[model samples]
Target: MAGLLDIVDQAQAIACEDILKVDAFLNHQIDPELMQAIGAAFAQHFQNDQIDKILTVESSGIAPAVFTGLALHVPVVFARKLSGFYGENVKWLPFADMQNSWWISILITLVLMGLVSLLLALNGFFRK
Candidate 1:
C-alpha cells in the first residue's frame, strides 16, 4: 500500500503560496489505480464485517465506493446531491433533501434501520 505522503506527492496540483488544487487526480479526473488501492485499504480494515452495502455521498465518492463494493461483493448506494436543476424523475428514491432538515433526519433513520437489520441477519447467520 502506498503511504499517505507518497499518494500526496503523486497527486497533481497547482500550488500557490498558500493554496493548492488537486482536481486533476483527486477530485475532477480520478486515477483508477489509486482508487483501487484506496478501496483495497478500506476493505482490509473492515474485512471482518459482513458488509451488504457500501453507502457514500455522490460525485467524488462514487469511484472508490464502487471499487470497495466490488471488493466486498456488495451493492453501492450513494446519496444524490440536489442541485438547482432537476431533470426527469429517476428510478431511485431521493436519498436526501439538503434544504430540508426533516428529510435529512428521515434519511439517516432509514439508513440506520437498514444497517441494524443487516447486522442482525449477519449475526444470526454466524451463530447458526
Candidate 2:
C-alpha cells in the first residue's frame, strides 16, 4: 500500500493555498489501498471522538467512508447527490440551485427521514 505522503505527491496542483486535486487516487483511478490507509488514518484521528456513524456524500467518499466505518466498527451513511452537487471533494455548497429546487429539499428531507427511521429501527428505538 502507498503511504500518505506518497499519495499526496500524486495529487495534481490546482493553484490553491492548501488544496490539491485527489482524483488520481480517489476518484479517477480509485486506489483502494490508499483509501484503506486513509480510513485507518481517519479512524486513528477520530477514535477518541466516540463517533457512532460516518456521514459523507456519495461517489468517491463512499470508498474511504466505508473503510473508515470498518476500521471504527461503525455504520457509514452517504448522502445521495442530486444534480450539480456532484464533486470530488466537499469545499462549498451550490446555493443558487438549491434555492431554485424545492423538490431537492423535499427529497433530501425524505432521505434524512428514511435514514433516521432505519437507524431507529435498527437500534430498537422504534418498538411496536
What are the RMSD figures for all models against the true structure?
A: 8.0, 7.8
Candidate lDDT values, in order:
0.74, 0.78
Off by over 4 Å in 2: 10-19, 84-128
Model 1 residue 76 CA deviation in Å: 0.4
Position 98, candidate 2: lDDT: 64
Writing each residue's lDDT as its tens digit, candidate 2 over 40-67 gives 9999999898778887887888999999
For model 2, state the Cα shift of residue 90 in Å.
Answer: 20
Error of 2 at 74 (Å): 0.7
Q: For model 1, state the Cα shift of residue 12 in Å.
A: 4.9
The alpha-carbon root-mean-square deviation between model 2 and the true structure, to one decimal in Å, is: 7.8
Q: What would the TM-scores of all predictions be? A: 0.56, 0.56
Question: Clashes per prediction?
Answer: 0, 0
Candidate number with greatest lDDT = 2
Model 1: runs farther than 4 Å from truth? 1-4, 12-21, 84-128
